[model samples]
Target chain A: MFDLPDAAALPRLRPASSRPSLGLIGHGAFGAFIHPHLARFFDVVVHDPADSASASLASVAARQIVVLAVPLAQMRGVAVAIAPHLRPGALVVDVCSLKVAPLAILAEALPEHVEILGTHPLFGPQSGKAGIAGLRIALCPLRGRRARLAAQLLRRGFGLEVVQSTAEEHDRQMAYVQGLTHIVSRIVLAMDVPPLELRTTTFEHLTRMVDTVRHDSEALFRTIARDNPYAAEVRERFAAATAEVMERLGAP
Target chain B: MFDLPDAAALPRLRPASSRPSLGLIGHGAFGAFIHPHLARFFDVVVHDPADSASASLASVAARQIVVLAVPLAQMRGVAVAIAPHLRPGALVVDVCSLKVAPLAILAEALPEHVEILGTHPLFGPQSGKAGIAGLRIALCPLRGRRARLAAQLLRRGFGLEVVQSTAEEHDRQMAYVQGLTHIVSRIVLAMDVPPLELRTTTFEHLTRMVDTVRHDSEALFRTIARDNPYAAEVRERFAAATAEVMERLGAP
Candidate 1:
């Protein structure tokens, strides 16, 4: 049932039984997209309540590594649900767009015995439809030393560019990057501009940018526009700058 | 002093003496960038008041084909200046971002005996730096049948995609295409976003779009935003859409 055509070609140097056990807690778009890649290096057990193929939450959370790929709105509830079942020294990783809030929630909800790692893969099904190699992932070490090992594994094994950053720093930069992009995309999509035969290179670039973010979920857009603390300031700056541009253009 | 490395390799089946004489006004950025390409098919004589290397205005305007590449604000004055010198059978071509106003001015100022054609090469020095073979150029036949010959020559000789459209229809499409792009670029540039380490594919696309129009002249920006009749409506729609997005996100 898996759509991975490149699964057979993956290097199977180690046996499945000898690999570490990875517990995945969601079967949404991102969770499903990352399953096969994680399966190559770990024996994975999924625990999505909505999916019939998932294992029990207790059994999945007892693995050596637990990955929370649920939506940002559900991060706190899921973290609390898995806290009691996590084993000592287990690493808890989160793949969320905004790091500060989710990482804070994980730190307050999960047990101190378990290590916490905050990661933003920076790509999804649309961008990684072919393969995820050469893509970027931000690693934020929230509560332990395991983030370095995770960084090394992602860099060497998956051919990813790992950028080590703190939750605050990541959120600050994303305020402009993700925040501005989603805002512009949403506004342009709302404009509903008609298709035209005459287009310039700059207009094509704007169209491609809008197309990339058009398929993102409303929850994701909300997380990017509202969840990040610095996002409001960036949006304000953008609005003011837009007003200045309109004034300069003598817009009626 | 031209930066064109592909000049020598251009097809030269016909001798220079047999080619039609082309008078080019305004040795500005676009005029200079397009000079070599026109030089391949015609004997070019440039007339720029600011450039010492330019020929006299009378001498340049007397050629078989007179090309007006001046700024939109200066278009009426230049058209009036050349009206006395234009030959009866000569063809006049204008390369401007917005077609309707410039074409109207040319029709009003120039003699009816000379033909008029309006063209907008969608790429500039930055976008066409490598080569302009596959680039697009919008051709609006304003006054006469000479536009068809110009289209065939651009399509066959330079491998350009010539889109035949009327001046009004071209301006309507461009009000969204060029107008929105330049407006968004100006606003983003005014925002002064800092250098970000963590960037998504969509953010990169936005940055590249801004970069493409970042170096564009303010005159061009003004022409795209002010010269087109429908531009004000687009800006109003974009502003209203931005307000809706902000309201949906509960922007404080």
Candidate 2:
């Protein structure tokens, strides 16, 4: 259902040798998970400060497409570092959990001649462990025409369901989506309830959600819980709702 | 996986005409849901004050096997009303959400000659709509050996997974399983968030869990959140954990 137009229905494709070079920053868990999928269509080069085998930042930034896979906290620094080396008309994409701030940073730091696409792939290494086919990716065409092509490519190449949204709209919805999910998961995990043998279907679904986000990095949690502009309000509302429920139940 | 020994391996079974009479009280949502399932193997008779078509209380209570599917608050009253009519050696079962208090009430109100089986079928009309195969039902043999036979029948006949435990153990585990799920779902529902266009896999799981319990009666919610002896502690722990998480995130 997520398939786009047949690969042959599009403009003529370049040969493998002439395929566009793509650079990826941050060889983190998500970066590693996505690297292979991106490699199927591009001559991919990766640069991560912590990886000894990574390509130099300058060479990686000069590619036709550059994807920033860094943490939200580090996005600005990476964007600034790559700005000087990014070739004109390069399509710069960011795979951040929150869209508004990261996209803003990319827009501010990148050269005006470059294109920007903001994406948040809804699945992660844990959720996408089997395969990413039919998974969702939210695409924000922050700047220029390349973002539309990127959305089409995401759909056609990877069989992803792309939801086209603006950075503001994406982050607004994510305040409830990612923000509420992560907070609830963290609370349940912290409650430290032992493994229960009497599992209900609802409880199993709740725990599955908890387990999927259990291994996520603390940085991602902070990004979703704090970095998103609307997340704090959502968190506060949830906490208030929880308190009201406890009060109604007369739980002291 | 929930199957018991083959039905043919059991002691010779009675023909359909000779099937033991089963009486069910409190034809509420759950009572109606389970009525057909019980009718499959027994000559089932149902009694409910609200259901005008139901059988008379005295006649229903005098059956060879009697089941009470009532709210936790009304359990004692139902047991008291049925006490004088229970036949000797009659197998009486109460399907309440919490096992401890209801089992205690049944033990106190019912005559010593009548057997008592406390069961918490971990599903209802909403979750069981698709079919109850492999669904779980907690069985507490409070006062009889007949509980084992009932468990076997539940497995072999209805494809139910029976977890046999004492009343205390059942309530304790359900404090986490049912208690946590209901409370979280209530909080999310009360938050009154609009339908989101951007949904993650985890969020989808969360919402699905919420939807399963959305139609549950307020009485069931109270039974899970207030009737269970251990539920308050779990709710308190969840509240405390939510506070800690919000504080850590610097969320007001």
Candidate 3:
């Protein structure tokens, strides 16, 4: 039951209650950025694990929708804390960058009755600062009515293009997307700022790009590069391609 | 002599009469785009070798100023064809992407009496279509009064910022500027275009960048990579850093 319809449908299927009570669990940059938007259609309540322990998380499970907005490293702990309280028919979701890693934690930690969804909001606070009306969010349906709700909320309510994919396929796509950009950026920033005289628009634009992600936490960089199963192969391809280009230039 | 004059000297230097009759040696995209601008300030003649042969080369040497507008690969032959015809007083200039390589060819191939100036206009016809009033042009004075004249035309007339540097310094700087960008762009373009649903704004911008340089001739790519002496070292650094990042990502 997805919103994938035909000719007049042109795209997807399904229709459910558009607005559901959402229990958001995290208040980091991304979490806070999307809070106001989610609050529009959702009877929303946010829980920050750092502020107070199980008490805050307890408030989330009773709601119709529970979203885990914590970091990748903290997924298992978050899943465990909320699993007990999520009763039957309630949907749980996550908005992490990598899909497979966090979704797996949710499946292993949560009970069978708790329906689940995995999402990766492609833009962050900086990119979304202008408003994320036309942004992209990858949606992977795990179980129950919540997947349809995610598609509706992400597509209709917020105007995001909800790209439907499985957790494995999402991770595979991200290996080149999230994985390659970060790797290329990191490698470029590791060098000193090139002198002013030599700078061109292309180089200047690239430097500005590096500045945008300069504050990305080391933990996040390490996790993305290491966690996604497909990253290693993409990295090898990058290396081989780089070598070939250089060899074509006659580099020994 | 650089063009760093005080407040009263700001308006200009050397009267318009000091500008001599100009001869443009190629009429490709850049040459055509700039021909009208060059004509605005001086008596101008354009000779594209592809269109005409010895006669066009003959027309260039008699002019007070001769500019090589040919590609990097064609610089030596261009210089040779014009060498015997250039008068002792003429100033010769080249606007190749890699300044050192073509300037060296110009220096060796042309007669000693023909003064040389190495330059790189940092924008292309596409970028400059909106009028090139505020762009940058690197100026490396190799001989005579030609460099100052170039700085004047680019600055006071066309509003280009002329960064004074040596050919070696220019090449060293461009090793990262032109070298890294083309390499990064080429590598990114080598990957298949990701599906539309999965596209983010950043990815969209990167794809557009690939489009910008997509039509770059293979000879242009190879000449820039191989001819610039400092490019090999930069390529090596990029490779080493890429490997280190992939290793940190846990690649075998």
Candidate 4:
């Protein structure tokens, strides 16, 4: 299911020389990850302003397939900056946790001729530290050649399990998947430390999540809570459920 | 720290004839586990009322070491029933997750001459399905003998790490460790299921915790919430933290 366009359908894709070079904008952790794997399939043009002060934005936008790997908050600025220089018929992909916001930013900022595809490489620096083989990546095809280019590159190139999803469905599920998880971890870390001896195996397993989001930048944690539309509802439900459990047990 | 009594301390314990016969009461899942290991060190007599309604409580109490593996709520009645029959100088061990309550019940219900030892063998059937070499079992020595028998049986007999602690400290630490874990899991399971495709490595780790608490008996869960002194406080703090995070995100 992940490999939607199979080997038989490969013939329909444009030939090698006609295909676009991968334009990887933003050189953060995710950008660094997608670049090398992207290079394996096509020539990669990287534009990380942080590393090169005078980096030419037009050069990166000129590529046929561009990946937006900037922080979630920076999507708008980056999309607007590179919109004018994006080549016609190019596919601009986003690698953001929450799809709806980034997809909207990319769709409105880029020219009508440019296509959009959204993806969330669920693994990060630590999890993807080894390699991304067998890892999960959500693919939301927005405006484009049915996301054929993005699907082909992610599955065939990186050996990732591409779960085809909608921008709405991706954000809805991530509200609980990423939103609830990060909320619990961030809060638990904020609490006083429990005695080490009382940490059971299940507790150890639960805290692996604490380790997952523990060192994340405050910006990323806030983005999961604020950016996802369904996050508010999920948080309210989680808080309500916890309150009910405690109330049933009576006060402390 | 786990191996409190090294090999040198073994000599301080009584010999085979001087050591007490193991009398295991309430052959529940945990009781069955403790029986076999007790048999390895001493003769064991099991009296499970569920299996044999006419089970002679006197026979079990007559032994020198009687392990009360009854449900948390049943501890008081079980102790009262066997108190009169308990052999002189015998040690009654209560294996309950929340130590403060059970320890109090056992100490109050038993004869003053009857020694009390409280222990929580932190692993369950599923967790200990494999070898339990590195598992932890908290030993809260109460009334008499400093719980040397239980310490030796758990550490040397079962290859477990015995954490020597008082009932108060064990219950205190467990409030955050177990109370928060069970509270989050119970609340999560109560909520609507998120899309399965969105289960990441961390989410999968989290759901493992849910699985750990899912099949647990309602009586057990209620005890975790109601019996432990710190459980209510931890649950309140967790609920408040969740609410604060939602408010900070400006979400409902």
Candidate 5:
């Protein structure tokens, strides 16, 4: 169970420094993808328990902001372990795909003295071949006056489109949009037809999607599909649609 | 009730000249799109059934090639009506989305003396904006030596990739690739979300698809989705998948 902060009681932590020191909890593809851009705004410290120790991230821990870019399933444990080492009053936020689950986890794990916020970058690292010029970011405020400020930094400094929504609403919509789209793409890829056989514009479109999620970690897929309570419902709906269509085609 | 040539007995046709006179049987968006390009290959003639008569099509019937760029449902009827007027041994072809049905229609409707073939340009008029450089054209051979020649013109003259396949197989696969993709895209468009609310990368992808088909005529959509026998099966499978996902989401 998590102790969520009241909307009215959140803290406001804004520093006067030109560049904030930032600690990142995951160094996976998503972490590596956003780190360089984020480094322009904040001094970045990256920590991945699966890859590195707390001592490794200590050098960057002195920064003003801490960012958790870990898998949704591991977010809680990493937040708890890193909570003690974070600098006092450092604004902590996450870039997880699902908001509600991680928001709950971070709220429960972090100390009351620390500020917490959650964010979801709408575009995958693989999506931006050019750069993050027109990408969107969803910011879910948990317990901080710094939440809006942190979101503004992402928007103004980095040119990200920021949308504010509750963690629950974000998860509910994501279940339909992200989860179902990925599942459909996965099913298409699993069919394993040769590229030459796929000539239709529609097949080409589906191929783009399959390519998008092909590099994602299995853990990431599992977390998004299973950890989010709304995902199962979305997946089930897609499966039912597939089944009915197959039945009409006399397909098993 | 439609008479068609034996699939196994269909003969290929050869191109008549380096610059053949071309007759276009429809004057709608697709016909207009192809008209300018046809001018490069033949002395072009344009006819629209709603506006032009058989006598007008016959005025240009002296051309070596006649391209039926009309709607799929009207393709057979037009072919039969225009057959008696075409020059002997002239090559007649169609640009319909469905091959099997139209192939049969042309084979039965055209005079035995005139060469007939069915061609599906695996692209739209919008593709003309880039020129036909790397696009694909599917050739479904029906009668005469015109089929082989048509393939050559599509390749050597316009620089399109030519794919040869039976009309039945083409329609079967297109049901899944084209029909299902269009159906899903329409569903997304029908969701009626305001443009301001749709900011996600996934939604952007879906919107691109919706935009592609939005300008297409309802007859084209119906022909691709309903008239093509294989489409029902493919759409059924896709609809089933969507339903399955929706059911999981507990959508009523």
Candidate 6:
């Protein structure tokens, strides 16, 4: 019974300046998705070395909250490159799926004057039609007063169910949530059923899962399955259960 | 583009009174599910040594279609016992998940006078609010004229997408559809995340699959995994794909 406050009841959070600015690091699907929503709230700037940030995004880079939404592997390098450009006391946040490692990277790379916060939006960009209406966003605070202020702003401004969890706890839970889900989906895809013959409700559900992760970049899958410390343990338990079932069924 | 004719267009079918009265060999969850739907069309009789047939199901025992909706391991025995009581020319059908092995058992045990057909409803009985509106139902015609008539009656009356496939083909595809889905759902359950921490869209999808299968009896799981010939091959492919991903990710 959590009563989410009405949007009107929340404090009118105008970005500290005449026109608040926001910078996003990863311009991939998730970044592109949140960009439109953030643009409504602040002047948004995005940096993705892999792809050119859109013209609209590039136009707003001068004065904004710089967000590093890159892959965990490239987060440090991206943060280092963008740190010099950010205005003093500009709020910096990384939207990496994994937290602890990236949070540490952002803390060490950015200037002490710039505030840093690590966030992982639990839903994916492809969750089309099911917008971020009832979703959880995990926020792990790393740096100064501005970082806390940014988290509060997200809660007060957008009706986001913000849960404060340590970077370690976040990754541990993510191992089971993200790591096992992808693994299970990959296994289902490997079954190689000719699409014509697939007709069960269960098969359709499994195919949905496979379709969700299969198109995702290899780097993203690897980072989720290997880089996150809790992933290995979760994977082991999944493998054990699979083996046990196979043994019981005497399957090859 | 497949055009499935509406139920009203099909010829009005009447159960052949000359045939032996219908008999239901098992009164389990699946049996109870289709029982009401079937009762609407034909006079029905049930004989479940394990569980007493409900009063309503027992009331229509005089002469009707004989259905065996039992666990795979007990199916053959039930078929043998019910064979003696079936009225002459009674059309026998099974709602078992696996088809090939059970088809063979029914063919061997039932009296030649009694026609047998193996039927597998693609949707679960407990598919609560989402009723079997657009679901596919596989019908493997095993014997006589009565069996064909029974299959046609189901297609015409229920508006079910009735696909005619051999018992072998049905079992082969089921390996990927049922076996793989169950294996993936069980793996998600084995991950052992605290309920609060598991909030991802992918996780929610996985939990729905687990919830669908967890209420299923072990005998049901075993039947799909063990009795179905195609299950081992599907399981092997799933295992291989999982191993390939793990190896690619350099996971020990």
Q: Estimate each model's TM-score.
A: 0.93, 0.94, 0.82, 0.85, 0.75, 0.86
Give residue A9's error in model 4 in angstroms. 16
- Calculate the i-RMS of every candidate, to one decimal place: 0.8, 0.8, 2.3, 1.5, 4.7, 2.0
CAPRI grade of model 1: medium
Error of 5 at B94 (Å): 0.6
Over 4 Å off in model 5, which ranges? A1-20, A39-43, A52-63, A145-180, A190-194, A197-203, A217-252, B1-20, B52-63, B125-133, B146-149, B156-159, B190-198, B217-219, B225-252
Candidate 4 per-residue lDDT over residues A91-157, each given as its tens digit: 7888888888888888788899888888888888767777888999999888967477566657766
Instruction: Give one digit per residue, the lDDT tens place, for model 5 in B128-174.
Output: 46676887778888887656656766776677888998888888777
Residue B27's C-alpha lDDT in candidate 6? 72
Task: Write the candidate numbers in order of decreasing DockQ.
Answer: 2, 1, 4, 6, 3, 5
* lDDT, residue A44, model 4: 76
Off by over 4 Å in 1: A1-12, B1-12
lDDT of 2 by residue, B1-252 (tens): 012234555466657767778899988889999999887778899999898888899999999989998898898888999999999888898888888898889999999998888888988898899999999999988886676778888887788999988889889999999999999999999899877998999998898899889999988898899878898799789978987887878853
Second chain of candidate 2: TM-score? 0.93
DockQ-wise, the better of 2 and 6 is 2
State the lDDT at B225 in candidate 3: 67
B167 in model 4: Cα distance from truth in Å?
1.7
lDDT of 1 by residue, A23-97 (tens): 999989899999999987788999998987679999999999999999999998999999999999898999999
Among the candidates, what TM-score does chain A have in each? Answer: 0.92, 0.93, 0.84, 0.86, 0.86, 0.84
Best by TM-score: 2
lDDT (CA) for every model shown? 0.87, 0.87, 0.75, 0.78, 0.68, 0.70
Give candidate 6 misplaced runs (Cα > 4 Å): A1-18, A51-62, A146-159, A196-198, B1-22, B52-62, B128-130, B146-156
**Strongest candidate by DockQ:** 2
- Worst lDDT window (10 residues) for model 3 chain B? B1-10
lDDT of 4 by residue, B154-188 (tens): 77766889898888899888887788778778888
Q: List, for all models, the DockQ compared with the true complex.
A: 0.78, 0.80, 0.38, 0.54, 0.19, 0.51
